[model samples]
Target: TPVNHTFGISGGKQFKVGADNNPLSFFIVGSHGTNYSYTGELIRNTTSDGTIYQDQQGDKYSQNINQLVLGNINFGINKAHNLAYNFMMVHANNQYVGQYSGKHTESHQDSNDYTGRAIRQQTNDNLLFTHQLISSWKLSNKMKLNAGASYNRIKGLEPDRRENYLSKQDDGTYILTGSNRQKRFFSELKENDINTKVNLQYKLNDEFDNTNSALEIGYNGRFVDDKFEAVEYNFDALSGTFPIDNLQLDDLYNQANYESGKYTMSVGELNTYNVKKNVHSAYAEATYQLTSPLTANVGLRVDNVDMTVNHRVQHVEPGRESIKKTYFLPSLNLKYDLNDKNAIRMGLSKTYTLPQSKEISPYQYVNIGFASQGNPNLKPSDNYNADLKWDYYLSPSELFTVTGFFKHIVNPIGRVDQGNSAGLLSYSNISAFATVAGIEVELRKNLINRVNTATSKVNRVSLGLNASYIYTDLEVDIVNTPRR
Candidate 1:
């Protein structure tokens, strides 16, 4: 892996008032970031007809500049009551430039690899704003209440343009053909979300067992709305011969200046879509000491999700998609202390992983050699997991642990190849069931711990290591797919 070059500047300030017991404070932070890099394979030389020829090299270039500002304010009415507010805003501009060798003749072309001279550029601008407010109150000596609400809004613009310049090659090398080919694509998205949550925690005083216990309950609600628009430009440029044999990043950027209208752009395909999501959830958890050296914790959560999508179709009725899903998740954890230096723990849980916005959106993302399309029919995956662990403490600064875990997953999602001329990449549910098992061990030891009183020099050295081996099996049909 190669690291990109980055430059960043950040500054913050804080103001506080009142005494330590009850204080009001406000803080603000701002940052500016800039990053750029060029990535590509090593240059290669090929010998043909007893002559050494340098193969055309491709480069992927990217740049990003962003500004982030965040601020927070907090105040306490008394020792038992407090309120806080936080807000953040981020603005960014990012660009990706991909260049590849152009296509070759049928006799010399390779289906699996990209050949030829082509350049593609995509630039996007993004803005995100978020705000949250929270309050904490001590209802009693054994009970506390906490509540918060948050709002977030995001806006982005994605625009792509590409140019292809090709000429007949007798010796497997490109020539300046002077024919200019260009295409443009543009898209935008605006999204907003609001969430509110309230939680209560109560302490259980077990005077007889002389142990600690607690119970917590919470409710949460969220609402979200997203709008998307995309357009492809259809234009006919004048056929002209150019003097340049090879295209450069600077040349592409100069030609595809949308803001300056360097090239004529016309609407070809127009797509409009919108999505709405609503979620409601409730959860409860309890932790209790079963014995003097044992403890157990159990939790249950229920969630209801409602989602709808509206996509405009050409020469047809509006395409409307909607779905409602509910999930009941439960988990249990148990711990037993054999002694002051050794302990055993066990856990079991059921969880679900939902598809993200880009995964479900009916959009196409194009690259130089490949393109990825989203699936609107994607479903969430479910997981049932269990784990057992043992821990041994050698000292405060050293310890060792070993764990074994298992997971059973249903409806897993993975990338699938469409095997087309466009080199299409799409996502789908590849397996009905899958199982994974793993064991991991970790150790941390301090080699040296000493101090020189007269010279005031101290040396403390430690070593930490961890490793895991996992085995996975999937029950699915793999016909006409690449083997792994």
Candidate 2:
């Protein structure tokens, strides 16, 4: 005999706005939410062992929104010829429901019965636009130059649904010996992205000379298009009764009846799947300073990945693929000032990550009591990191610091089990390795001052404290592995 249950929640939000005078500004925001839940279990049997019942229930709801218009404008005439604008919109929704039931009894016959139910829903939406421009120039002796450009647009949407059921029974009037199942699912997705960027800076001496140094370069790009759709449905049923009581089984089942004869039947199935993805990227970076504690950084990148798959079952086959990659990264930093309160710092870096589009997309789904499959030959993971730091300042607000780190990781991905007991799963890429070491600590002080209450002067008292911790160790060598 055991039982447990819980529920508690409340929510609110609201706003309104209107104001204009050329350099625009407008706003509106809203929100709402809810929750509910219940649980149960009961068993009774005195002296003869047998009587049990159980129950469960759940519910949820949500809502949201945001809208905005912002501004600043002046075409040209000096003051750096300015212009800026922004517009935005967003929305959200969520829902959930659940249920369960059970029963059992002995001596008076009826041994067991069970039932279950579930439902879920979700929604999301977004829209945005932005623009900007600024310029300035002056070149002579202590030269100067500044430039800028920006533009962006984005849109998104998502949808989801789920439903499930289960049943079982045996004995005393609740006749239906046992076996029932049901499933339903639906999904939708859409996305779009576009971006642009530009910037430049240069300065040559003007009493601002640590032996003169200032120059930078930048470039950015992005393009993404995505779409997906899914659907599924299933049902099962079984019936039983034989021997112990057969009253000639209704005249031997209508004398072995046949009018379109097709006996012993059970069948129900429906399925669908679709997928698409496209992504592109471009990046560039450069920064330089060859004095005042030396520094330099460099970067270059390029990428393209594409995929497509469709299925409705019939030996099931439809596929498309594309991949292209290029990357070169360089980094360096050094600082030395062993005076006026000590200092030393050093750094190095290189990084890359890519592989998750449902782990390469080959699509297969049926959840909870399992059947999930996806793996289109996945690959792409790399990292290299180095660090050293030491700083100390005893007075002028007191401080002390220390840091050391090292990392190396490559091609690691996992999920495996494919012998099935009516549950199947697969996804693989592993040649694993891991190592990590960490330390961080901080402390601050200022406790109490100003306390005189009889009518304000108690100027908000103070006390402060902080703490941190991290530790990791992992080693794997393939042979039925699971650790996270």
Candidate 3:
């Protein structure tokens, strides 16, 4: 059974410049899409004493997708200042074709009936881009200023991905097996980032008569770069007799089977990487009216991080690395106004968690039921937070809430199951300590406020429900590790 199709289109525009007190504006939007699918499947593998390990495949597949949405356009060159842009792209294809009909029974002691036919194809290309610039000023009469800059980019590609395996002879034609030949894969990934910010605010009294004292300060910056590469190619049969016909998709690879020797190509072992990161932050905050239904906010922050990595697993070895960090962070917030439909809240925080660039890029990604690796000494994780809150407001359109949270973590990165790679999967820090606790409850209801109703079944609905409960604990710390 095969039939699934989708297509889309979208558009928008608006423009008006100057005039109207202080105005300048422009806006634009766009979208495009495509999709198609055909699938048939039934794959089985069972064992746990029920026998029949790896029993089959009806597994037929086809999928194609293309999407491009470079939407979002912002405007305003007057009344402060602004700019924005965003873009996204995707193109994907997946193909798996025919006859892998059933039963091999854990490599046959006698449950055989697996004649084989395999063809696989996978492709994906993705991208995203973003930009923003902002400004605000009126640096007098109680002081104010703001600034911003942003840039981002991402790309991913997997090309050449192909696979072939065949065996079914007896004159119906098909043969290509040096046990299992023809496989080609190539992968690439890229990332980019730039960010900057500045802020200053002050108004300790009368911005309209001393309501609360206020002050703020900020500086933030970020820079990043990442890259990844992969390769694989193998095609056996260096001598002839590589026959294949009629099982379509262009029967066999061309150039008359690579100038007539039928096959021979090998290359695997190029899993490359590069990563760079920079982070800088400075912050200050103050807001008070610590009396009069009580209100307070206090903050302090400092951070500097630099990261570098250059890995090349070419022939093997040379897993470069670097890291530097400094942090001094703190925060607090509290508010109480037990009237006006009740209110109380509290929060405290300190945080850190880094280890990206594919989790410190050591790079290993093998498929067909498992393999994942990365950890060039991977480190960075420290977070502590606390929260408590209460809210009630049943009228300005309903509300009720409750929250409780706690977390304590240090060097707690996770993703296990690699006691030296059998079926691999890695990412570590195993855990020096970890803890999390949670509680959340909420209820909001509006039901309908559409004045005028006379039951012909008046319908206008609004209702929401929320729930939560969480607990976690970990303390693993490897080395002689025997606890599965």
Candidate 4:
């Protein structure tokens, strides 16, 4: 037989506004919100086989703020040519806090306990501008073009702390305690993008045969700089003083020493690291309708990525530095409409993931009697993906879709045990390859319609259910050992 218990709480709020003038309009809004929650659990078991027990507890709090402001104005000579422009800004912030604890006791009269805590926060801001020139030009036909550019900036921060304690008793009983603290890391990022596009349409017949197409190209470049720092401490203490009525005095003393001091070894560590990434990309896309039911769409994009890492250490050697080789990415997308109710889509792309800044940091930290260190020689992982998709309309309001995808990864990375160090286990990276395949299914239907009664109309009613499953397989070779 077993027993259990649990508890928790949460809450939040928001606000907004809009205004307009004859030839111009404007909108501005700002909002703030927060949420807090705490949870705890305890379990006890006892039976003919033995006695077992466990307990856990945790709490978290979060807060967020969002703001937006924008306005548009129009002015022109004789109103024949109108000049329109607008500017906008947005920002947000978030934070979190949490803690956990656990314990277990065996029938042999032995027991242990564990505990922990964590916190996190982030912030973001953006600014944008747009200008529109309205004019009609008659060359071979009528044409119009619109161009715009934007700038965005964002900042984020996160920090964390954790402590763990465990204790055991000769009667097979133990006690554990843990504490965690998180500091907000800080991040500053900026982006600039410029774009231009033109649209042309010509009248070809008396029946108003109009053919139209537009071409657009844009460049988006960004620079992101971030800093993260964390500190952690752990300690375990055990005491055994239980009297055994069935055991002799000498045997009790020996068992007490074994039960106590099992976790007297205490360890603490502090770590810090800095990372920056610079990314630049260019893209172009176009679409045309061959006919009413048959349409075609195509798009192409190219991306360039560069990243650098620097690490600082505490209570250890100075951290090392790592630079990632620049990477290039290209992608393609194609889609065709078979009918008003069906479509086919296909895509191919190349992508790369830079090593996590912390992974390349030469900093070393200790945890649970184990020490962890980053390898500065690690390299980025790369991948290639191709996919095909189909969409079908069972009815005007009901639809279903399916997609198949394949992804190939090179230099895949995973942690591998490097061995023990001073009674603590160490781990390092093991590069390998992986293959994945999966299927997706979806179904939707309108089960009921709103009912109108003499006194009042019933609100609209509908029901929906959806589910999906995915599986992955990986093959790897490490230290002459094959793994699957």
Q: Return the top candidate by lDDT.
A: 1
Ranking of predictions according to TM-score: 1, 4, 3, 2
> Lowest lDDT 10-mer window, candidate 4?
177-186
Best by TM-score: 1
Instruction: Output the lDDT of residue 125, model 3.
Output: 69
* RMSD to the hidden true structure, all candidates: 6.2, 27.3, 24.3, 11.3
lDDT of 4 at 220: 57
- Overlapping backbone residue pairs in candidate 2 total 0
- Which residue runs does candidate 4 get wrong by more than 4 Å? 1-166, 169-213, 231-270, 288-299, 314-328, 362-375, 394-397, 414-431, 449-465, 478-482
The superposed Cα distance between candidate 1 and the true structure at residue 471, in angstroms, equals 3.0
Per-residue alpha-carbon lDDT of candidate 4 for residues 60-132, written as tens digits (9 for 90 to 100): 4444444445444444323233344545554444444333334433323443332221111223333333333
Q: Alpha carbon lDDT of residue 193, candidate 1?
A: 95
> What would the per-residue lDDT of candidate 3 be over residues 437-477, giving only the tens digit for each residue?
98999998988767545655445578999999999988676
Q: lDDT at 233 for candidate 1? A: 64
Local distance difference test, per candidate? 0.74, 0.45, 0.71, 0.48
Query: What's the residue-level lDDT of 476 in candidate 1?
Result: 50
Candidate closer to the true structure by lDDT (higher is better), 2 or 4: 4
